[model samples]
Structures are given as C-alpha cells and as structure tokens.
Target chain A: MNYEAIVIGSSAGGLSALKSIIYNLPGNFSTPIIITQHVSSLSESYMAVFLNQLSQLVIKEADAGEKIKPGHVYIAPPNFHLLIEEDFTLNLTVDEKVNYSRPSIDILFETAALAFKRKLIGIILTGANNDGSNGIKQIKHFGGHTIAQLPASAEVPIMPQSAIDTGCVDKILSLEEITGYIISICH
Target chain B: MHLPDQLNNIQNIELTHFFELIFNVYGYDFRNYNKAHVKRRILNRINNLGLKSISELQHKVLHEEGFFDLILRDLSINVTEMYREPGFYKSLRNEIIPILRTYPYIKVWHAGCATGEEVYSFAILLQEEGLYDRSQIYATDFNPIVLETAKKAIYPVSKIKEYTLNYQKSGGKNSFSDYYVARYESVIFNQSLKKNIVFAEHNLVTDGVFAEVNLIICRNVLIYFNKELQNKVTGLFTESLIKGGYLGLGSKENLMFTDVFDQYQVVDAKEKIYKKTIFSSK
Candidate 1:
C-alpha cells in the first residue's frame, strides 16, 4: 500500500534498532516519519539532534501547529503527546498520560490512524508493555498498514509480542529488515 | 452476604458494569482509567447514594437518566479550589502574565475545569493583571452537571475562608471577600468575574481541539487518566496551543515522558509551567 506518513513507536533498546532502520533511508526520502521514543520529560532535544547527525533526513522535535513536510523525521518531545492533524500539521497536547507514558505509542498510533486513515503505516518496536497493541488494532481498523519488530530480534519482546498476538500486524520483521519492508510497502 | 465482602464484590461488578455501560451507551471510554481509583469512586457513589449494594446503584443508574448525573459527579473529580497550590498561581501571575499581556486579544482554554472555581480564579488573576478586558476563557468539563454548577459560580460560604487564605498566599492584591458576597449559606462570586468565561461540556477523553489559544491550563486531571488517555489529551492540548503559547499542568504533572516534552521549556519548573518553544512550530 502507498503511504504518505510512517509512524514508529519504540521503548527500551530502541536507539540501536532505530539507527539501523533510519540509517538505511536516503536523505531525499519523501515520506513524513513520526516517532515516539520513551524519554524523560526533562530530557533535552538530544534525540532529534542525534538522529539528524546519524541520518540524512532532517530530524527535529515536533512543534505544535507545525506543518508536516516530506523527507523529515519528527520526534515526539519528552513528556507531551504528538498528534498529526488531517491537514498534515502537528498538534501537541498535555491531556493525560496514556499507558503510563506521556509520549505514548498508543496516542501517536491512534491519532495517526484517525487523521491519516489508509495513508498511514504504524510500526511497533521493542518495549516492555502492551502499549502498542490497541494502537495497532486501531490502525488496522482504519485500513492502514501495521508492522511489528520480530519479538526474537527486539531488545524487549513484550511490546512487539503483544502487537503480534493481536493478529493485526501485517509484517513482523527484524530490525535490519524493517527499512526495506517500509520502503517496499510505501512504494 | 456480609457487608464488606458484599460491597467489595458489588464494587467490582458495578464498576465493570458501569464501564461497559458508559462505553456502550455514550461511547465515552473509561475502560482504561486507573482501576483502583475508579473502584473507590464507584464504591463511594454507592455509599453516598445510600444504596445497599453496588448492583442496586447500578440499576438506578441504568434505569434513571438523571441518576447518571450524580454518578458522573461521583466518577469525575470536583475537588478543585480557586488558587490551588498558591505557588503555581503565584508563578502564573508573575511569569505568565507579562507574556499574555503582549497579545491584544487572548483565548484561554481551561480543560477539565471542575465546578469552575479555577476558571474564576484565572479570571480574577487576569483582572488583577489588567488582562481580563482582552481575554476570553473557555472553561470546559466532561461532566455537564458540574458545568452547570460552575456556571452558577456559587459555593458554600464555609469554603470561602480557606479560599481567601489561598488567594492571599497566591499574591492577591485585593481583599478576597471583595470578590464575592455572602447570601445565607452561599457565597455568590462577582458576576463580572465570569463575564468573559464560557462554561461548556468537553470531554478531554473524546473531544477535539478548541482552536488557537494563548494558554491552556489542565492541572491535576492527568493523574486520573491511564497512560494512553493521558497521551491522547496531551495531543489535544498540543494541537490547541498556538506557537510559543503557554501550557500549564498540575504541580505534580510534568511533560517528561511524553513525546511533546522537547517542544516546551519550563518557564517555572517548580510550578509545572512551560512555554512552547519556537522549534515546536516545526
């Protein structure tokens, strides 16, 4: 399926996995990528700066009301939620903590499912909790594609295992292979 | 059945039933709330309603329409005061006021405002800062009954003594008694305080954004939502805040773990007041 946006949710041991997936993408890659990585609220913008340094894509923390652009990666800032609007702009809210997380994977995936519909692709990666399972279900219900990191290959298997157990995931791939799979599906 | 065990069992059963009923009938998702708190509140409601069992209270709630209103009050928190955590209000007055003063017209969303006390407190603060003339406050709560109570702006005169102390602690420049008149057992707040305030029913759980705003105050509400709901509401706030706008949470609430933390900088870290960053607009 062709997709305009790609959303990824990750928790423990996500950095290396994310590095492998993102490093493979060319700087000119046109799809808008949004990610939620568990981090402390007091955390700085190091992740965005680090990702930008590692990958060719323009990486930055998502801002409220900022328009989404192609070939850039938007990371949810620590402690707040990042939602995509139908108009392809970013909205930030301080509503509540979901799944005991502020930048909850569920919030990112669920809102993306609502706003992007079939044009969205949701990826659930390593984590301890079943945070991404319900979100994956919502994306599938919205006719969007869903993928999970292979439990065996994930740093923490519970999150991916949970998503896989939901029987909604369209793909379960190793971290190294995820980028190619994403490219293939988006094309 | 023994009373304690019966109440315990009834609490569990009624809570599950209430969760299912609210989800099915109203489509307001409360399934993932903190289970312990939800159960306690449910049990409290049963006792407050003077029902023998949770099942009996459940029956009343299901059969009688207005009973749900009382049930909602039991479920939703309404323990807010005018200047809760006086230090936070102090920070708002000192730090946030100057920023708000820059704008000619300001729109503020008081999400999850329970019983309107905090909304009036904010209105009063705006008045003191001379910003009330240009500000419009949209005070919203999920509980309609509470919204009505908020609109009335009436409270027990007994609570005013405590609230007056809070007002003074929060740097109020005027007499707290000057803002309200005591009639019988009730204190009627000045009507002018609510002139620019609009009280409405808005469920942060299921509602959409309320457009551009200069500041969004959603204190003490996030502690009740499960992580997923918390994130959802946070997203709503993020969507509603204008670039460089201010977002304030309960003193205990911090943006540390959410995806939007990097989007703001703590204006007063101790008070949980944050200023939206320019980079947030990206």
Candidate 2:
C-alpha cells in the first residue's frame, strides 16, 4: 500500500529511538511524518530544530491550521493535542489531558486514523505508558498498518509491549526493520 | 468507496444531521465547530450512555425532554483550571498592564471565559497592579450552566494546590491563601473579585461583536475551532478591539497562521500577545 502519512508515538527513552528511526529514511523521502513525544508541558520548540539538524526530514512544531504536506515532519507542540481535520490540516487543542499527557498519542493516532484511513501507518516506540495502544488499534480498525517496536530492542519496552498486548499490532519490528519497512511502504 | 468507508460516510452524515437537529430545535448552533472534535465528543456521549449509535443518540436528543442539555454539556467540556498558564498572566502583568494604565477606563473581555477561573485570575492580577478600580471586565461562555458557576467563584479544593502554584508562578503579590476561603471540599473566592466583572452567555460561534474594548483575553479557546471558524472569531476579536488594542491567545494558538495574521503585531511573542495594527492594508 502507498501510505501518505505516518504517526509515531514515544515517551521515555524516545530520543535515541526517534533519531535512529529518522536516520533510516532517505534524503529524498516523501511522506508526511507526524510525531508525539512526551515532554514536560514547559518543553520548548527546540526539539524540532534539533531533530531537523540531524535528519534529512524537514521538521518543525505543528502550527494550528498548517496544511499537512508530504516529506515534512510535524511534531506536536508541548501541552496541546494535535488533531487531524478532514481537510488534512492541523488543529491544536488544550482539552483535558488524555492518558495524563497533552499531545496524547491516542488523540493524534485516533484522529489521524479517521482522517487518513487505510492510507495511514502508526508506529509505537519506547515509552512508559499505554497511551498509543488504543490509538494503534483505531488505525488498524480503519484498515491501516500498525507497527510496534521490538520490546527487547527498545530503550523502554513497556510502551511497545503494551501495543503488542493489544493484538492489533501488525508487526513488532526492530528499529532497523521498522525503518526499512517504512521506506518500503511509503512513497 | 469500500463498505466500511461508506459506513463511515453514513455516520458522518448522521452526525451532521444531529447538529442540525440541535440547531433547529434549540436555536444553539454547533454546525461551525471542527467536525472531528464534534464527532469525538458525540461518540463519547454515545458510548457513555450505552447508546447504539450516533443516530440513536440523535433520536434521544430530539424526543427526550432535557436530553439536549446533557448533550450540550457534553459538547462543551468545561475542563479548565485557574491560572492555567502562569506565564501568560505573568507577561500580562509585566507587559500589558502598563499599557492599560494609560487609559483612564479600560474594558477587557474574557471571551470563552470557560468557568471564569482565568477571569478571576485576571481580576486578581489587575487588583494586584492596582488597576481594578478603573477596569470593567466582561466574562462570557456559551455554556450558561458554567456561567452561573463562574459567578459563584467556587472551585473544588482539590484544585487549590495547583492554582496556588500557578498563582505564585504568575507573580502573585500576596499569599494565594488570602484570596479564597477553603471550607470543606470547596474553596470560595473573595466576593470582591466579582465586583467589576459581568458573567454572561456569549457563543463565539454565533454571537456578534458585543464590546469594543482595550484587550481581549481569549486563551486556548480557539483550538476548538476549524480554520474558517478561527478566522471568523479572530475577525470578531478584531472588530471588538479598539485600534491598537491587545489580544492574548493561548501559547500554542498561533495568530500568524490565520487570514487576520497581518492585522496584528506581536506584543509579547512568548506569551502569544498581539496588538492590532493601527493601519491595516487589508
């Protein structure tokens, strides 16, 4: 399937995992990547800038109403639930924290699943919570692809393990395998 | 389209029809809200009430007496806290209050004021800065139930700790404890804070411009709106403000992405404070 968008979730121990995953994509990669990494509500805009410097993907914090474009990376701003509207534009919300986190993986994954349907891919990486587990299921329910990082290979295995527990996970690939699979399916 | 996709389309249609049923019967419009947000909230109501589907929910909403109020409350989640973003208020006290001092009389509208926590927060800040006497504050929310609750200024005592920390961080001049009397499970704020404040029902979706003011403190409210509604609300804010007036949005809310982007200059970038440009090319 030619996937148009990718939604990724990570929490504790997410930094290196995100870096390795981004490192695996080619310089000419051309699919939109949306990510939610758990950080303090006071976290700054530096994550996007730092990620952009290290990776080929053009990364920036998602601004409200910005059109979702291929080949770009959009990171959810701290303390806001980044939603995908029907028109494929971004909408940020200060709604109550879901799964005890704003920019909750479930909110992003579930909304993206509805918006992108079978054309979306959801990946769950190292984290401490089960925020993305239900989200990945929504993607799968909509006939989309779902992947969880191999628990043993993850810095924190609990998150991906939780996604695996859902039984909706399509694959539990190693970081390298995940990257290869993403490139193979996208664009 | 595939079967499930077609089914999804059907559900969407049902949801839109539900919105219209609501507007027609109640005269409260929600058709302009962000659809995904509306869909999720409606689905939550469906699941919570153990209803079979959105259409089922719609039937109950139309036929059952007072059922629409329950659904209305569900749609507008009054999930907010006092001094929610401390830094925004700190910036207001340090940067914006000085400018407001210039006016002999200042009018501030707390648009989408939610449950009025931030309205009281602003009042406290103004009182601390000694600007309360000359200020007229209008606090509004579409949810009338929350509006009444706001007028009482009572909050769960459980939230006091967080509000106290936020108060301190927001450069509060006095002990946070002094502002409210904590009795049992709730804390009642000082009644004097409500003196210059008027709490009313103002729906950002359908309400017209009601006040021409020096500042509009609407934070974190516009995120619920789609691109079109966001622009419309921003335009209302523009028309509501006097020339060169101030608008403070939530930290994550961007004034730059809207069609009205050029109409305002950033007054405090970090705090998301914008000043209406005196002369607009548009």
Candidate 3:
C-alpha cells in the first residue's frame, strides 16, 4: 500500500533505536512520523527536546487537537493516548490505557490504521512486552504495511518478536535498515 | 507446582493474559504495570471470581462477556474518600487557592480521580472559595465506566457523616450536606459540581500531556507504577504544566529520585505539593 505516514511503537530500548532511525532520515524527509515510546506518568518532555537535537526534523510532544505535518516528528506526551485523525491532525485522549500504557503503541497503531487505512506504515521496535502485536495486525488488516525490528538485532526483542509472531509483518529489519525501508515505501 | 512457583507463574502469565484480554475485548493495557501490583490485583480478581487458578479466571473472562467489567473493578484501585486526608485539602486551600484566585481562569487536572467523590469535594471547595466560576476541572481516569459513575455524582448517604468531618477539617466554610441531597440511602451531589468538570479516560503509564495547566493533582496513582513508569509520568506532568505551575502528589509520593527532582522545589513538603522551576529545555 502507498504510505504517507509512519507510526512507530517501542519501549525499553526504544530511545536508542528511535534515535538511530530518526538520525538517518534526511532533514528534508517529507513523511510524517508518530511515536509512542513507553513512558511513566511522571516523565518530562525531555525526550522530545533530546530527540530534537538528534535530527533536523521538528520534534514536539503531541498536543490535543494539534495538526500533523510532514518533516516533523511527534512524540506522545507521557500518560495520554495519541491517535491520528482522518484530517491528518493529532487527537489526544485520556481513554483507557492500552497494554498498561497511555501512549500505548497498540493504541496509536490501531487508531492510526483506522484513520490512515492503507496509507500508513506501522513499525514495532524494541520493547519488553507484546504491546504492538495486535496493532500491527490491525495495520495489516487495514491493508497498510507492517514491519518489526528483527528480534536478534533489537536491544529488547519481546516487542518485535511479538509483532512478528502475529504472522502479519511484511519485513523484520534492523534499526539501521528501517530508515531506508520507510523512505522507500513513503516515496 | 508449589505455591511460590504457582504465584510466580501467575505473575508472569497474568500481565500477558490481562494485556490480551484488554486488547481483544476491552482495549485497555495492563501489560507494563509493576508486576507485583498486577499480580496482587489479578489474585484478588481470581479470589473474587471464586476461581481456583489464574487460568480459570482467564478462561472465565475470555469466554464470559461482561466478566472483564468485574475484573476491571477488582484490578482498579478505587479506595478514595471525599476530602481525603483533610490536611492536603487544607493546605491546598491555604497555599494554592489564593494563588489560583489571581488567574482569570484556572485549569486543573485531577488525575486518577476515582468514583468522582474527590473531584466533587474539590469542586465544593472551589465553590466555597468563590473560584468555581473561573475554574475548569479535568477529571481523568483509565476506567471509563468508573468515570461514568463519577459523572453521576452519587454516593451512599452513610458516608456523608465521615465526609462532613473531613470537610470541616479541610477548612470547609459551610456544612458538607449543602452540596448534596440525601435521597433514601444515597446522597446525590449537586449537579453544579460537574459543571466545569470534563471526565475522560487517561492512562498515566502511556498517555501524553492533556493541556497547559496551572495545577496538576495526581494522587496515589503513581504508587501503582514502577520507577521507570513513574519517572516517565512525572516528566509528562512537568512538561504539561506551565512555568511556575503547581504539582500535587499523594502523600507517599516524591520526586527525589526522578530526573525532574531538581526541576521542582517542594512548596508544602508535608502535603507533597511542588512548584516547578524554570529550566533549560533538554
């Protein structure tokens, strides 16, 4: 399916993995990127600021009712679910926590799949839980592309392994290869 | 397996089972919660359901519709009271109310607000302070069904006597009974208390910031999370709060070990209240 957006979900080793992929994306990369990194309720927005320095892309915490833009990266603020809207805007909800996570990768991926349908690419990365598996299935069911970081290469493999075990993933690439794959698909 | 082995196995499988059950049926996440708490709650749920094993509880939940609802109530910690602790509310009135009065409008996030009693108590306090008209309270919880109960604003009338004592201790100016009507055995809180409250479902473990607010009150909820999850949640509140915004935590909660420790100074240490300090963006 042709994709205009990428939704990524990770935990545990997500920071380094995400940094690797974001760092590789060119400053001119035009597809929108959304991330749901597992975070605690007491966390600060330092992750956004930290990621902003790693890439030229605009990085900010997703705010309720904010618009999604290309060349920008939106990180889920701590303790709230972040979903994409059909209008290409961000919708923040205090809806039920998924997978014991507010910005649950599953919640983001599932909602994004419904919103973007086949025009989306869902990636499940390093983490210790099966948070993203069902979400990736939804992405595949919606006719979007689905990928997981190869468990052997992921810092924490449970999340990736869970996604792959769902039998819906189209590819399982390392963090370094994910950037190229995303670029190719979006282009 | 022996009891220890059985408990450990349940601990390991409980989260996975809970996660699957929530996603496939309820769409909620209990996967990353502190394992100890999850196990305890799951055990309590099993006992409540009169099941012999975790697998039995799981089977019942997966096969029996609406069983998830019962399990959710058992899993969720809803032990709360109006004017909880009294002292914290008193401190809020003494230290925070005056400051809030200066703003043209006030926004407060009462995170993990269970059953709505505490939210209603705060609303009554705000009304007594004459700040209700200018304030908006966003009462959020992970349990939407509980939130619906909160929105209903009803409680057992038997609890009102204790709530009255708490209200008085919390520096309430009028009789607590003024805010609710006693009907039969239940107390129906004044509908006006919810006028400015917006109830929504939010998971502190995975959700993002709600809004730029002057005050955030998340009590008792953080104790359910592990240190990593706690730190992440605190960071979200710190970022969502405006400069000089106030953060109030449960009495047992603290920021000493978090990355944001130096970013906030305790305002009323005894009350677990803090005021954010200006810091350079990371």
Judge candidate 2 at residue A150 and give its lDDT. 97
**What digit string (tens of lDDT, one per residue) describes model 3 on residues B196-256?**
9999999776688878898998887775555677789899999888887899986656777
Over the stretch A76-152, how does candidate 1's per-residue lDDT look in tens digits?
Answer: 97766777654576655554567888788887787677567778999999988888788899789778899999999
Candidate 3 wrongly placed segments (more than 4 Å): A1-187, B1-7, B10-26, B280-282
Write one digit per residue (lDDT tens) for candidate 1, span B1-282: 544334345556667777888778766668866554455456657667687766787688678877777767667867677787788899999898988898999999999898899999989999988989899999998988789999999999988977998899899999888899999999999999988998888888877986789999998787666567777778788888988999988855667657778888989987899888877853
TM-score of chain B of each: 0.90, 0.95, 0.91
DockQ each candidate and list the results. Answer: 0.01, 0.62, 0.01
Which stretches in model 2 have alpha-carbon errors above 4 Å?
B280-282
lDDT of each: 0.82, 0.89, 0.82
Clashing residue pairs in candidate 2 are none
Model 1 residue A145 CA deviation in Å: 52
Model 3 - which docking category?
incorrect
By summed lDDT, the worst window of 10 consecutive residues in model 2 chain A runs over A41-50
